[model samples]
Target: MFTTTAGKPLRYNHWRKSYFDSAVSAAGLADVTPHDLRAPHGTWVADRYGVMTAAHRLGTRTRA
Candidate 1:
């Protein structure tokens, strides 16, 4: 569901490594990967619902 201005699906690895890394680095989070962006979200969802539901929200399959 995510895309670039050219209407192509944003390449996950490239977007994460290039764009997201640079932005977070500029914001002083040099140690964070793009995937870390989901930590707070997953935590909130997990607290409100459960780990299984949080995983589902992140499109993951978990046995919790």
Candidate 2:
């Protein structure tokens, strides 16, 4: 759900190259992809909310 400076939707390849890659490199991280942030983001949400909330945020289905 990222957008370009002009407010157009950002394509994945462009975002990966122009934003994600640059940010990771600037942060001194290597070999990290956007998908790699999921686990930590889920944990952060779950800690403050709950597993179900995290699941919803992550678009994951959970058996009840």
Predicted structure with the largest lDDT when compared to the true one: 2
Residue by residue across 24-56, what tens digits does model 1's lDDT show? 878886688656779899999999999888899
Instruction: Identify the runs in model 2 with alpha carbons over 4 angstroms from their true place.
Output: 6-8
Question: How do the predictions measure up, each by TM-score?
Answer: 0.57, 0.82
> Weakest 10 consecutive residues, lDDT, candidate 1?
28-37
Name the top TM-score candidate. Answer: 2
**Model 2: per-residue lDDT, tens digit, 1-64?**
7788899999999989998999999999999999999999999999999989999999998888
Flag regions of model 1 displaced more than 4 Å.
59-64
Provide the RMSD of all predictions against the true structure, rounded to 1 decimal: 3.1, 1.8
Cα lDDT, all candidates:
0.85, 0.95
